[model samples]
Target chain A: MEILIIILLPIICTIMIAAVGRKSVFLRNLFVLIPTVGDFLLVGHLAWQVKSGGTAASLNLVDLSNFAIKFEASGISVYMALSMTFLWIMTAIYSFGYMEHEHAQVRYYAALVLNLAAAMGIVFASNLVTFFIFFELLTIAVYPLVVHEETDAAYLAGKVYGVYLLTGGAMVLMATVVLYCLTGTFDFVPGGIPALAQQSTFMLTVLFVLFTIGFGFKAALVPLCYWLPEAMIAPTPISAVLHAVAVVNVGVFGFVRVIYNIFGPTLYNKMGFGSVIAVMAAITILYSAFQGLRQKEIKRMLAMSTINQLSFMLLGLVSFSMIGMTGGLLHIYYHSFMKITLFYCAGAIITQSKNKYVANMGGLAKHMPITMTCFAVAAVGIVGLPPVAGWVSKWYMMQGFLEMGKPIYAIIFLLSSLIELGFFGPPIFRAFFRKEENNSFNFQQDTSKFGSEAPWAMLAPIVIVAFFSVLFGFWGFVPHGLVKPALSGLLGKGF
Target chain B: MITNSWLLFFAVFIPLVSAPLSLIFSDKVSNRFTALSNVVNFLVIAGMYSAVSHGKLLVLELNTGFNFKLSFMADSLSLLCGLIFIAVWTLTSFYSIGYMSHEHAQRRYNLFSLLSLAGTLGVVFTRNLFSLYIFFEILSVASYVMVVHEESFEARKAGLKYILMGIIGGLTLLLAMVCTYHITGTVDLL
Candidate 1:
């Protein structure tokens, strides 16, 4: 019951906000912010309970003979839930200012909260059925957000988004049903389903292919992806949740559950799923990096870079080594903070200066110094070039890949970093290094006259999440401690 | 007091009924009608989750006559996949409300989309290679109309390429099915 409340609170509040939000802006924003903060507190309490007691708390909503819908707070679920809740809170705060003058406040606030609920449901689900239900709901709930702009282009993007993700959902559904028929249970066991090993290699291979392609859609695997870039038609906060926090990581979460909990390391090795996933991850990593360079829109470039960076987590999981999985899991947290910061900075820039194109953003630091500096910090962290969160996760990923006897992945990582720098380094270089453009009406000049920065609502969250990216670099265990027990769940006791 | 077979039966039958219905109705009526049909299809399949999870695989056999048989296999996997197709189709139907409101021939578009839905459901639920091949062709043929629904120059050209590739695929599948039937003396998979 306690666990269930944590999931339902945001949804209930979403309804409340939608119902009463039309009255006033302050009340509307309050309804949105209160639930997010409330969910964060509830999740924090749940995390404390899990950490102190060392056992998961679960609630079962339905039992239909062999299949049951249950939500549990295991180490992995707790970690993901906490991270998602934190991002939701940050996004809500940022939206308070970003959406001040925007229309459709009621719809926007409702969808935002509902999206958080669906994401938390994904994190807390103990079985495949629960996860699938929430995952499908997520597809529907976020559609309104994507098409919120209501332009012809947004509708077309929404259609493409629906086709791609639901097709992926279809494949995932196929795999789930097949696994249930074979094993007679949908509960996620820690170290793989034992019965799965007894199945024929052909059956196993078919299941793997279905699961991979299904989850790969949102994970942005190379061949089956183009929707993520197109989905940037959404508003910035929604894009942050899509790219940094919720949708993409849920896809990665699916991969984690599939690899560690469904197939486990032993079976994953025996079946050689690692090599298959590694090849896909390697291609997406470098390909998206090079592709990011061609993007002129800052958000689209970040979207492409997101597609690139997300593959690191996938490669980490497919390495099938403990350190690799740890790195992958930790990167989920590290990347969330870093990427959300970058997106927040981008959003602030857009809201403040209306500078959407990177080519026109030269010498932006003269006015928006804090925003550009935060962007630079995040950009450096993404390149893994310094003593930051990205470096820590990258070191572990490289070590994991090398230990798995796949040095090609290590090379891919190194090369993608160089290419990553190529795209992200320019804005920083142009911001501070180059002279400010001579346009008399540039926002930089106008804002410089008043010494204005982004509104406090937006600037605070940007600074906070960016600060975490650097803070976590020095003290890795803040998020890492949450992940260690989950890693051990896959790698046996010592890990 | 619905039996598991009823659920399986309606899951396959509703789309068949809606395909023609989509063609006859006025634009507004047909849109709502197709959207309603999608919802009902999704509900029927969701109800099958219990029986499916109970490990009672719902197999409905249709006797077409003269020792020929067609079967719909509602194993957990097929049922789940059925749910996916219905769900996507439902959302797309709603999306089409906003997307196709301005386009010409709304009735025709609704008709082909609903027809393709039926065909896709057939492909997802069929168990035997013979039935799978048949429904696969049904899906390909129905969706080809959608690819060319715009009837623009580019849509026509793409439709031509689509039909060409589809024929090649259909022929390859037919050859494989024929070879397997000849070698094994049966078309059912397991």
Candidate 2:
């Protein structure tokens, strides 16, 4: 019950404030601030409880005398909830001044809170059914945020988002029904569906494909991934939440939950689907990395890169090795911080200097040193360079592939890392070292004469997250008793 | 006995009620008042979240004039969606304050926003396929007003396209629901 309150309080407060703050701008803004802090504290408390090895609280509500409402947090859920709440607090703080001059500041804040609440719900959900509900809610909640610009391009992007996700959502709904009918329960159990394991392999194979495609849309595996790059049409804060933290993470999280909890590695291994999944993941990684190299728009490149990086996590999981699952989970946090920094830097460049393309970013490092520096650190992290968080995950993935004796995947992983360097390295290098063109690109008065580096609101979150990229990397090196045990609980012993 | 179920029914009704209230108050003060009503309704929903989170299930059961009971339950899944609906409703309200500040029919917009939220909440909370269909249709109707809120030809055209596609999706959903109920002998979610 207490745990549930932590998630619901902000949502309640957001509505009350919006209603009451109608006439007073100061009051409205002030009202929004209260819930932002309140939710963060709640998440912090949950994290503390988890770190101390406390048992998670559970809540169940019965509806229509038939269905049950259930929520619980294990160590994994608590950690993820804390990550989301922490990022949300920073993003909300940033949105404060970022929306100062924008119209509909109230709506922006309200949407931010809603997105946060849905994300937290996703993190804490105890079962696949609950997870799917929040997953779809996340999809709808983000649509308006994406079309916040209300331009033709934004509208079109919103449409593509609807088509891809809604279709995928339908598949999830169908799969859930099928599973429920077979098992008579929708709760996530570690190891997987014992009942399904008893069924014919052909039936299980079909079901596995359904589950894979349903979850794969959000994971952004190729053919189903076109929606992600287009979704970059949303605002920067939205990009941070949707692409890096909440939306995509929910997809990846669902995939892990389904594989490890519903199917269990033992059965998944016996089914011979692990190799198939790995092959698809490797293809997506190399393919999207190649796509990222050809993009000129910084956000589009980052979006393509997200598809590729996401595949890295999937590849790690598909290896079914302990090292691989750990790599996958760590990458969830590491990739989020790194990608968010890159997106923030891109947003800052666009908003501050009106530069959206890499071709135009020559000499940017000199003008906006803080933004470019953060961008460079983040780029290194994304490229899997040492001492950065991305390196830890990539290293574990390599070990996982090797342990699985999949030499082809190990080679592909290395090739993909090099491709990552190919795509992310040159842009940062060119930003700093390349000479300014003699054309109109040079001698142009500093665009920031009108504004300094993006408002402190925006810059603060990016910088803090960049710092987290390094901090989490170091944390990965230290023996954290919590994460390893949690991974063991999910993956089982002998992992 | 039916009155208890009205609470769940009212979750959907409040928005439709607000629509008329907005029409009646179509002035500035009325718009403020309508916003206030929405806030109040949102708070009640929040209370529901708390009650549900506390392991209390708020079940509203109604006979659909057919054989089945039209039911709404605040389960974990519904609670998640309800939380999101209320949150988005609040923010979009604030946003509309800025985005639609100078537009006419501010009351209409607020009314429809509430209706959409209510409809969406109903879709998530209800366990019955029939009720889900009803709420889904309401959501479709209510959101169209938002898509066409600008009342411009382009906005109206987009709304039309949105509605047409939604209708097609709705029909598919309806067929699925009917097939499910026919095969299972109940529209209630297990």
Individual DockQ of the candidates? 0.01, 0.01
lDDT of 1 by residue, B1-190 (tens): 2133766667866976787778678888888888999999999889888888888877777653212256677887888888888999999999988888888768767877876787788778776765575556557656776887765668767876885576456545644554464457577864
Q: Please state the Cα-based DockQ of model 2 relative to the true two-chain complex.
A: 0.01
In order, what lDDT does every prediction score? 0.79, 0.73
TM-score of chain A, all candidates: 0.97, 0.93
| Residue-by-residue lDDT tens digits, candidate 1, A257-349 | 888778777898778898888888899998899899999999999998898988999998887766677788888888898899999999998
| Model 2 chain A poorest 10 in a row by lDDT | A435-444
Going through the candidates in order, the fraction of native interface contacts each one reproduces equals: 0.00, 0.00
State the local distance difference test value for candidate 1: 0.79
Off by over 4 Å in 1: A438-445, A449-452, A490-495, B1-190
Can you list the residue pairs that collide in candidate 1? Answer: none
Off by over 4 Å in 2: A20-22, A63-66, A438-451, A477-481, A492-495, B1-190
State iRMS for model 1: 28.0
Clashing pairs in 2: A69-B76, A107-B94, A107-B95, A110-B91, A191-A264, A192-A262, A192-A263
